[model samples]
Target: MYTLLIVDDESIAVRGMKQGIVWSDLAITEILEAYNVKQAKQLFANHQIDIMICDIEMPGQNGIELLEWTRTHYPDTVSLFLTAHADFTYVQKALQLGSFDYILKPVKHEQLKDITGQAVLQWKKNEEKKTFSVLHKQYVQQWEEQLPHLIERFWQELLGERVLPKSKQIAAKLQQLNIPLTLDDQVLPILISIEMWKEEFNARDEEIMEYALRKTASELMLASWPGTVIQDRNGINLLLIYVKPTDPIIRDEVQKICEEYIRYCNQYFKCSLSCYIGESTKITEIPGMYSDLLVMERNNVSASNKVILANEQLQVRPFFDSSATSFPVMDWIMLFELGRKEELLEQMTESCTYMEQKSGFCKEDLESMHTSILFLLFSVFHKKGLSVYEAFPSKQLIDSTINIRTLEQFRTWMYKVISQGIGHFMLHAKEESEIVIKTKKYISEHIHQEFSREDIASYVFLNPSYLSRLFKKETGISLTDYILKERMNEAKRLLVQTEMKISQIAESLGYMNLSHFITMFKKVNGATPMNFRKKIQ
Candidate 1:
């Protein structure tokens, strides 16, 4: 409801408005009458006045002075000026002082009524927003002061250090504060966190970033959960979502919304976004589930900004075989160095295909893959005497990190980076050859050491998927298959030339179990270890 304050020294004009205008029809709840500026200020101080309709000429304090004071102090209050004088100077001053409108003394009741109604409607909107903010602030404070203790108890019960009764007690206290939850009821919360772009933004900017993210999250929560999204708090905006039959669908909707929002931020705001979805459990279980989500997201820095459900699959697996497949890592390096952007983009389709295949990777694996690729690219850039920042820059780094949120984003970023400076990038292709050679050397030596495909990764420090693909591209053999073949040949040599027992040879070759050794040997050589030994002899 909007409250209007009418200030006029002329009694006749004030009576005319009160009698001629339908205040109720205009939706003005309280029509406060003030004879002078002092009385109007007193009313403003005491009550919530949305609009002030005052006479420009008044005793002691004039409407101009009153409007100026309201402009500074009661900025939320819309000011409307009234005066018998049709002075252009007064009209100009009123306009300059931020008055909503200035009406001459012989005010037309119809015009005055219509303008007041419009002002009232606008004021109501502003008032509602103000009311919500006040409520949000009050509750946010309550949650902040109490959440730490509640979370501590929640953890204790989750870890079995405390009992259910304690958890119930904490839930009861939250209910007392009108948060409205019980130990029996489940609470599903989406965990939102920001990954700073290497501290480039200052404190104020970071605060603004958090605020923007919170607003976006809040809007998404409203869209997805409607009334169930009670309140949000801190930099980590936890939306108190109600778990229902359509929850998975609801969560998916929320995830889609957040992904778009995060993409916008990356494209327009340049902030790194990461989100973790927690399971729907009893409200008391939120802390435990959230802790797990945080740990999962922390251990995996390359996750997307989408809301992840608690029980959702999250692992680091090979989503793309860079050796068997093609990615634009090389093309991008070449383009970035040579500045052949047009040609680089022309080669982007293949690279995008590889990144799109990364959808099969769990959130954790996707993030790890992102990290590994960045490190490798940085290394490649540094080896070629190019600055990592100069070639890729911080913004690109953030985009690449956030790009894994979706296959499309990944592809988009890959294309954008690949199409940078193609001709200039060819120079860095020198390291590609060296990286391939180093990878083979490491594998040849470490083949006898039970070297898994991933273990061969330390040689070039690329991701296992990337190295696996790179080796096959260069040597036409998978790293693991190559390692297995080498190990079998070494075993056959030991079996024939050295009087080494099968068990001894197995232990020497980093196999702990004799049966396991025989299985692997037969799998590779098409014969049992003993048979191979006899045949070799």
Candidate 2:
């Protein structure tokens, strides 16, 4: 609803206009009447007036002056000038002040209604545009702010909550802006595999390696052509060059560049380096292409060490699929535990090989697959008393900015680590599985004896907290709750079949404090123990 202010110095004009016009029918619900400009100004400040119908020549302040005031302050408020005199200058001045439409004195009812309706439509359109612009900007800003945190959480889950020192990763990510890729744009994703020969190195050394890599990559690309590149720590360098390629024969120009650097660095230091070039992708598809590159790189570990290789045909299209089928990776792990080793290995090897083959996959696609696989892997690993960090042991590789191109690479890299990890952790899982079953047996045999989580933990040789989490994950209920349910069920049975008293039943279930046992029984069953017995009887 909009408020329309009527301003006129003449008393008769104001009365006739107010009474004669049906403001409500015109879609102007609220009306404020002012005899002069001063009261109109006060009304304008206090309320949101959509349209001002004011007399041109007033006693104190004219309509022209009022329009000027509105123009300066309340610009959104539409102004319609009313003039008695047929002065050309006054008409021109009203238009110059941006009056919606001016009406001469003794205005026709038809003209007034038509103009008001037009002004209302214009006002609504402007408001809608304003709303849409605000919403769009807000949505973009929220994603911009939240994207990094979400990415970090994803990597954390992928690596199984392994805390890697993040300064290098943070610096690399900060350097890489989210550049949009178009089909026409020539963006190159270079996956550089970096390794340290020396075991002892501090944060300073890591920073130096990052700086050397970025500087070297930048200098080489800039010297070759006029281009700008942002190097992320992931060891994946993205170069966006506008230069037209001079050599038509240069089949692997990007690979050549990476190989030259790798060879140069290897000669200078004991540290080995390898670089892989993913297929050239349009800007919009870079993220998905980057992921495929990572997968491809992981698979490359199985191949003989090459400083750099250009896999021009390493496309990311194969990895882009629905996540619905991906969730079975956990179910695969459980199947592995059930001695379906052949099926488990086949699935793991196949999936890893696929990722290894497509290291040039875009970051968006890579992260999606990465999240799906990591969650599945973690579900089983966490259940079996191992964290993701311990299972993968490739935080450096997984967290790197370098694009993985192929499933073969991921297969080669992950298979060994995961298989060895299984060997190390499987025995512990068996032990825990044994303890869990034993604990259940102990509880059933000695339900009349006092038991605490600490006692169970001690018997199982596991941490109390870890055991609690494991019990909940495995059984979908807490240890204490399961025990209580069992005891309560036994008490109910005894009450109906053996004619046991409520106090005796409580004692039989290992509760020395009869009142406490009765309270627990009431809480679980929503009735007193005696009442439960009576009802059952």
Candidate 3:
């Protein structure tokens, strides 16, 4: 419903028009009568007039002036002129004032009603347009608010191989996300590894402190450069600095900034962080550079609170001869037993890289590696109170150890077996007491089975209630939580390493209900099984 105002000099003219017109048929709910522009202005000030009909030659202010004022103040209201004269001058002036239509004096009620109906239709269209514009702006604002998160998600997918690494695809996604980056842009990946915290803190506290470190790095280290600091899935902070080819001194500048950031973190946050500066490459190569930096960080076992350049690490080659003397087997055993996997792997890689560079793999080199691995396996199993045969149940351990012919094959086998042995040993070693260790080992060994508190307690030879309390007191996590955590961790490993379907993975984790497994996975990882696989695979 709309309000209509009629203006004229004579009362009878206004009264006749107001009474004669069938306003209700045109959807006009209220009809206001005014003898002059002054009265019409007052009526307009009080009510929201949708349409106005006025006489052209009123005293003081004419219909042309009223139309001009209405057009300026309430442009949405449609105006029509009623006049005794059909003079060209009057009609021209009314049209110039933006009146909707010009009706002759002594107007027929039907003709006036038809014009009002048309005006009402136009008004409704304008209102709809206004509403649509408001809605469009609201949605645009919402998109802008969510743009940062979307960009982060896109980068996560790109880094995780969920999105293809082609330049065209990356550029298209950048445009869609409104990120001011392109395929041609040079991006340097700086891996920030938080080494040690001087203060004791819980998991949530550590997360908050890490977030603060990232924010500080963004503001203090890369303030002059355009970049973003993202925490990868492995909890490693990566700062991608976008540089131009013209900026030749950026690498040195970034190195200095990272050194300064390290000092600041040590001073203020009571934490030591290692910054691995990667070579600047095109945006499309960021994922590769990111992976390289992670490797570099892992190999940085002997250094902390320092800036290590990727170029320098790449340049490090084996300086010793592999055939001259065998590498220290006892040192490798010590590092492995100490759970220094990174240092162990780094030493092995350095030795192999040097050996391969010097004379390739010889019989002596193979014997030396085999001896060291055997020593490591024997010592590791002995400390855990297990024999070599018991440690490896699937195969004859000595037979596999004796069959290594090449350095490449030995290296592959070494990594697989060493990583598994260290992982298993560390899981049991984390429990402070023997009973807790037994409970943890049992949970790990039977992770695929649907076991309860009673089942685990029976396997560990303890009362269920006592075992639960002891496990919590020793490990700071309940037995049930420990089982779930182990299952989720295994699920993650399988998702990344294998091409098994989601349902199969869930079943392997002892989840009979696919939806329940997905819900639980999402609860732990913030992503479903399928999405998590996409992120890692």
Candidate 4:
């Protein structure tokens, strides 16, 4: 008899699985249920579970996380994942975590029984290895199968600086993982960077494709040398070839292998990538070589689908400037204000495209472009009276700009900030003519004060051009005309009702020069201020 555990967030589904499955047929007499990963972990702690059928999607912790834990703590327990998520990431993680089977849910009763019976059979097979020789054989077989992954992990840890990089520590780890290498051994490292993806893929798909690429590189490039391709903590792929630095033909072989590899990847993996090769160095010194190759990749913006060596003409130079330095940051403000959306975006795209295609453009170029666009957009937003936070909306969208990795990503973020900021300005620029009414009200309040259009604009918190354009567009009158009309009408009010002279009326209406005020009043009200007062009387 075998014990089994069913883990699903839906208690009803767990109940159904417990009641529907005939455990006796599969020699599984006991069954347990857990609502989530935490509860399932609790069940595992108490029981000697031989089989576990867990759902992949749960609230607190996912089935993959539980499976990872189970594999570490209870490797003998055969685990199967039952999940609605057919996501490639989940499937990949499940397999990597040593899950016995991945059964998609809404699985038929017969299918469940068949799968569960197979799981039981596998568990029983493990349980049957009771003799010391049989146990030893099983362990040896498992170790052999796991040796590659272990070695890869060791390399990752060593280069990632997670483990001690001393010679003794390194030699001990190499021996433990059965990797045939020593401190004196030299290894040439090459950095592979995915410049472009011809096909679209999610994060997990990209990871799997990277894995496939590494395996392919191992097959093609490391056939003659004793080496392997391992990924660093930063997700950078490095091909470590164990050979002497004095090997004369190694550089040529690296170039040939990289050329063929790039062609194969471009055709098969649907990606355009470049390989940056570094010189041979000691195993511990591989990290330094990897860092140098990374510098080459980061600095190269135009070169892709080719092999580059450390001593090449296009080498990593000192801190320097890009080809496109003088980007027109000032012109973007005018384009935005004029609502030239398509023209501005086209120009920006052309600039970034040039950077992507031209040499000497690097991470610093992308950063400069990003900074210029951000400054221009924010200046436009401030001029148009839109809040920066409201324009961006999501915090992540703005925060993502802090660590831009590629030209494409930089261009994408630029477009998002531009489209959102300029689009918002376009949407709200005309603003229901309320600012026009507000401007008129502020002018009326200070009609007697000697205030220019600048003062009124300051009061209304708008640019003078914005205040002027909006006032004219919405009120069908120029700001000067509107102010003149209001002040003349106020002069007329003082002319008839109050016992003030025409000169006093003009002066009270903020026209210190009475003669000049009369000329302006005559132009607006069809008569001079003094004449208009006599006519009204």
Model 3 residue 172 distance off true place after TM-score fit, in angstroms: 2.0
Deviating ranges (above 4 Å) for candidate 1: 1-165, 226-237, 244-249, 304-309, 312-537
lDDT of each: 0.63, 0.62, 0.75, 0.75
Better of 1 and 2 by lDDT: 1
TM per candidate comes to 0.29, 0.41, 0.60, 0.36
> 192-221, model 1: which lDDT tens digit per residue?
655433223333455576667666666655
lDDT of 3 by residue, 68-167 (tens): 8898888888888888988999899888877778899789988888887888888899899999999999999999998866876777776766325677
**What is the Å distance of residue 147 in model 1 from its true position?**
12
Question: How many clashing residue pairs, candidate 4?
Answer: 0
* Candidate number of the best TM-score: 3
Off by over 4 Å in 3: 84-98, 162-166, 246-249, 314-537
Scanning candidate 4 in windows of ten residues, the lowest lDDT window is 315-324
- Sorting all predicted structures by TM-score, with the top scorer first, yields 3, 2, 4, 1
